[model samples]
Target chain A: MEATVALIAEHFNGALSPTFFELITFANKLKIVTQAKPTIVMLGEEIEEVANKATHFNGFDVIAIEVPGLASYNPETYKAVLKSFLEELKPSFVCLVQTSTGADLAPALSVKLGAACISSVQEISSESGRITFLRSVLGGKAQAVFSAMTDITVVSIQPGCFERADTGACSGNVNVSRRAYRSLRIQDLGVRPGPGCDLLLSEAKVIISAGRGIRQKQNLALLFELAAMFSRSAVGCTRPLSDSGWLNSGSQVGLSGAIVSPDLYVACGISGAQQHIAGMQGSGFVVAINTDHYAPIFNHSDVCVVCDVIEFAPELIKAIAKYRQVT
Target chain B: MRILLCIKEVPETDAPIMLDQASRWIRDNNLHCYRMNRFDECAVEEAVLIKEKFPDSILDVVTVGPKRAEKILLRALGMGVDNATHILSEHTGYLSPFITASWIAKFASDKDYDLILTGVISEDNMQGQTGPMIAELLSMPCATSVIFERISYEERLIYVEREIESGARHCMKILLPALLTVQSGINKPRYPSLSKTLRAKKLRIPVICSDALLKVETRERPELIRHPSKSRQSLILEGTLSEKALELAAILDKKSLIK
Candidate 1:
């Protein structure tokens, strides 16, 4: 029987974000899901904690690797420990979905395990026993396909590629084991927080995005005011604004910048470059306000207003303020 | 000191990238196929700078790609890398970070190198896997997203300055015989000279396969899901530029979108 193992974080806190649940959605769709019960390899206590919340779920088995000391992500250790588990189980297919942490570890794990891996895969299908994989390339400008001869395949699906699974009352069998880090040769000095605002890029929902529009640094006040409408949203910008040092580098969104998939994406004065589009392509709704009708952003916008933001700024603010007062 | 800098050959991003109708991928015809990713180029540039700083050190470029990738290696050689090793694998088209790492780690294991370097992430996958993954396979240390730095051979340590959130920069120090993944802005990679390119053409390379290093772990066939093109009716936003602006303001205000 072809057994499939899904490598996921254990903390099943029903509160798993779209990125976390994306793994579950993909795993359930596997052709092997019906024939062979899928098994999930959970790392650390948080993932295990989440798994416990989801033990009643159907469609797969849940195994937790008790690496208590692994409070933070270390690529070397995750690869070593995951590789060891993989070697022991030798599942037909092992899918490692990418989170910020998994993206770091999946490649190293693939190398060590001598496995065929597909990174940032959008979809997978098997026919006549051969599996074909597909992924986006060149900052989402193109997609590529690849096939492997080995029976075991490692893949890290991109976030937002699949419909999220409902976590209510789902359960599966659980297996717990302790991990030995003998395969890992590296040691961590410690986890140093990344530089800047420390804004959680993955969790942002409402975003006020800027581009070449605002014209100058002082013009960012307009974006800040827009962002103030939603408690969950933050301000973002295209590469130009971030590159020119006019805005916080952390808030930049594009292929070279942070990938943001907010519920509401407000692109202001931003000429939508392809590279920039790749980052926010997954946003739920995009509203672009630009003066130029030929701006490429107008082509992709859900709602577009062709007018000068500079001329409309004060009145828009006043109107919203009035609305807020009335409400 | 000996260093193995891993490079990849990717389609130039500046060109108009369009997929062939038959296959669901970009048609790489007349499009320029040369130039490593921006970040990998930065990594190679860092290696060259390191070599210049320490004339006694030797820098070797190694890449796990098809025959076409050798063009990049030769380009690196012409730009001043001593020599290169191409672990030739025909099936590299499906070479994920894991498989690429396996091929690279197996090759690196054979060579006596004091350090390994790669781009923080390739513009292609943007996953940034090889450096850290190879470190795990070889059981070595790794640091990703390094923007600027200098390496010390004597102390076997790397001093790095990286940009992070809020325009903040952090200085980090990591011990070597370690792996380093650099971002594109670190250093602009140089152009290879004609003479160096000629000399590099004569250089010999070694080709290896993943099968020789480890057993077949698995071959996953990922499906290519095309993002359907969405055609939106564009309302050419027009009017007495100022009046149009007011009209747009009224619309935006009605939506409660912008304040």
Candidate 2:
């Protein structure tokens, strides 16, 4: 039998998450690097639908572990179940999505199996007969390439980094396994809804978003004024502003907040971290304004305006007004 | 209750970082300023809050880094940590999260701490693995991205709210002697007090050499450090502020984005 590369699948609201396909894509890439069979292990209740969908992908073997009591995700149960099962398999690599659950589970799992655990892996390459995983460090300022020395390596693949794995005409085999829920130290209470839906942000055609660069809460008025210039515009911000209580959580745009793909995204004073970029990368046109010329946000932007947002916002607003009146 | 908080010192986020000559790691010479990891500051604040609530609770902060990392430990001490331990690593470079966790777990094993806390992830490395890894090494239950937590002393249990993707919150209950990786924004971290700073300055914190801990084989090694590729048509607009703004307006006008 070929050495196995296990992809841990996560699901939300009964359906396979969109990221699962990304995980499959990641596993497919890993298959090339490690020369191992790609397998997906999904844990949840009523996961048959997800398992069936997983088998449709090419070059993957799906294993659905159904624990009826696990109606929701509990780290302790996840650790307990995966620890015993993975130890027996002793796969060459374990792949997981770099989400909250994966971030929490990968480290603990590595300790259990004594395997190397790498998180937020964005790229992989094989050089000189050794496989290495590339990830960002220093808040995306630098990238670090890591090679695992252990027999078994666990990695959390960064979402939206890889192309989706192509599905072949024929489906692969999927194995269904049932496990009784052993009493766990932690108990899951399901998910509670967060501050309503962000319909304003989602529906806005133009979004002017602020970041720590706004400096103070009062400066947000400038972003709002900029947004008022457009008929369908709305104001938004990065995680720090929301975390600091300067903006409501609903107005926050990032991986943990709303994922908005407005027609025009004006990122003012945002450094363009991966989490913030993931949310707005799908925008039709992006304009980044910041004082620092090397802000990573510029890398993803179509128009990079290297200026202090506080000083530039009013100038841009005046320019827009003058241009509008003349036209 | 006894709580152990793990903090890390990191370069300011905006600090200019460059790859060394060999391209193996970042050059440390350019790092003129360092502070506690932003997430770890939240962890320190959370531990301090817990200590405030349970007056009798003892809080200890530990860090695994070189000599310069002592500054973050002192900051934690100034924030009300009763004790400080520095697991000193003489070498300067990327230390694998595995080694750091191993050293912490070894030191914590005999300390009989009831709770271990750390930031959800380090801002520099952004791995978010050390806390949970320590829990696994200690065979304790663990939670990550914890935004809210409440302890019930009589029941010896902790109720926590973990923030997942898309702003959803997962509420769970864990038994005591557990570990938690605190998410940012859980609380506003208080600045180090002047009095505490004066006292902390006079106190000598115990430092343990990395060699003192059992040598755990490093399982992963970094081969390269470089900047990420630009994924867009980054057309940097040049000229004065007004000229740039006019250029932007023209682009938007061409796209019919502006009326």
Per-model C-alpha RMSD: 6.7, 1.5
Per residue, candidate 1 scores C-alpha lDDT tens digits across B1-259 of 7888998877765444545554434454545465677677778888889888888778888887667777788888888889788877666233456667767887788777778889877765666777877877777767676777777667777776554332334455666777888765566678878998898788786655546766534344334424323335445455565554455445555665543
Give, for candidate 1 chain B, the lowest lDDT window spanning 10 residues: B222-231
Question: What is the TM-score (0 to 1) of candidate 1?
Answer: 0.70
lDDT of each: 0.66, 0.87
TM, every model:
0.70, 0.97
Candidate 1 structure quality by residue, lDDT tens digits, A141-254: 555666766556667887657667664545767777786553243444333444333275557667888877788888888778867765577888886576567775677786
> Each candidate: how many clashes?
36, 1
Each candidate's DockQ score against the native complex?
Answer: 0.28, 0.78
Instruction: List native contact recovery per candidate, as a fraction of 1.
Output: 0.35, 0.83
